[model samples]
Target: MSFDIPDDRQYLESHEWALETDGVVRVGITDFAQDELGDVVFVELPGEGDHLKQEDDLGVIESIKAVSDLYAPVSGEVTAVNEALFDAPELVNEDPFGEGWMLEIDADDTAELEALLTAEAYEDQIA
Candidate 1:
């Protein structure tokens, strides 16, 4: 269950991560999640500009194995969604942290990111 998490990002117990850039936080499912879920078949994403609370169910990702909810890592208003996922959901299983990113939000509070798990902590759980 061990996985490598990028030092530059913060992770959630739900197997999501937040990558902050210029006040906006990019969100995506972890590699472990995609691997467990098998091939991604579809994605249901929140619309741009939609306000969300921390831990809110922002979307659903359908995979060959099962459907999993995608939550907001922190409270914010969604600024963008990866529209490409609509046409090519497999990218989630192929390159989860790269082209598989789900959405970006203008973060409401930077401190919210602190509540997430560190890479070591995340690995411990899945291990």
Candidate 2:
């Protein structure tokens, strides 16, 4: 099966994607992840100002088929959360990369993003 793995971001083996602009990194699940999760029913996310470590438990994403834990892609303070997910969880399924973005963090170390997978590497991993 094929998945949408955008070139502009880095990815985790666990299926989270991170796109850094300036010092902030926006995060969300990969399209393959959402497809596997089925219809997203609920999302639990950290609030603004919450500090997180890379790989920390950021929140939960509940889908019709299973509940999954979302991990932090980069360590830092959460700057924003997608409140739209609370009201329309299906956005996760509909647009995992855009309007479905889960959060944005002011990265503690922007260099950390270098450790993440490139779109080609991620596509290979999922393949």
Candidate 3:
């Protein structure tokens, strides 16, 4: 099996992906994660301005097969939430990296991203 692991972002062993740009980090689940979960039915996410610690519970993603907890890959204040998911959760299955992005956070420490896995390493992990 193969998965889409973009080199532009960092990944957690738990399957969250984080892409940082100008101090803000966008987060979402990986394609492999969505695939394993089956079709996403709903997503529960933190509101804007919510503060989160690294590894904190970010939210829940419900799929036909299972419910999964999403974790914060970096500590920070949530800057935005993808409201679109509430209406069309299937976006997670169609575009895990783009329109399916869960949230964006103003990271407390951008350097923290360095601790995450690279695309190559993440690919190896799911392999």
Candidate numbers sorted by lDDT from highest down: 3, 2, 1
Please, what is the whole-model Cα lDDT of each candidate in the order they appear? 0.91, 0.96, 0.96
Error of 2 at 20 (Å): 0.3
Q: Looking at candidate 2, what is the lDDT of residue 11? A: 96
As for candidate 3, its clashing pairs are none
lDDT of 2: 0.96
TM-score of each: 0.96, 0.98, 0.98
Model 1 Cα lDDT, one tens digit per residue, 1-127 = 4565777898989999899998899999998999899999999999999999999999999988899998899899999999999999999888888999999999999789999988778777788
Query: Which 10 consecutive residues of model 1 have the lowest summed lDDT?
Result: 1-10
RMSD of 3: 0.5
Q: Which digits, one per residue and each the tens of the lDDT, describe model 3 over residues 13-80? A: 99999999999999999999999999999999999999999899999999999999999999999999
Error of 3 at 106 (Å): 0.2
* Candidate 1 segments whose C-alpha is farther than 4 A from its true place: none
Instruction: Quote the lDDT for 115 in model 3.
Output: 92
How much does candidate 2 score in TM-score? 0.98
Which run of 10 residues does model 2 get worst, by summed lDDT? 1-10
Per-model clash counts, in order, read 0, 0, 0
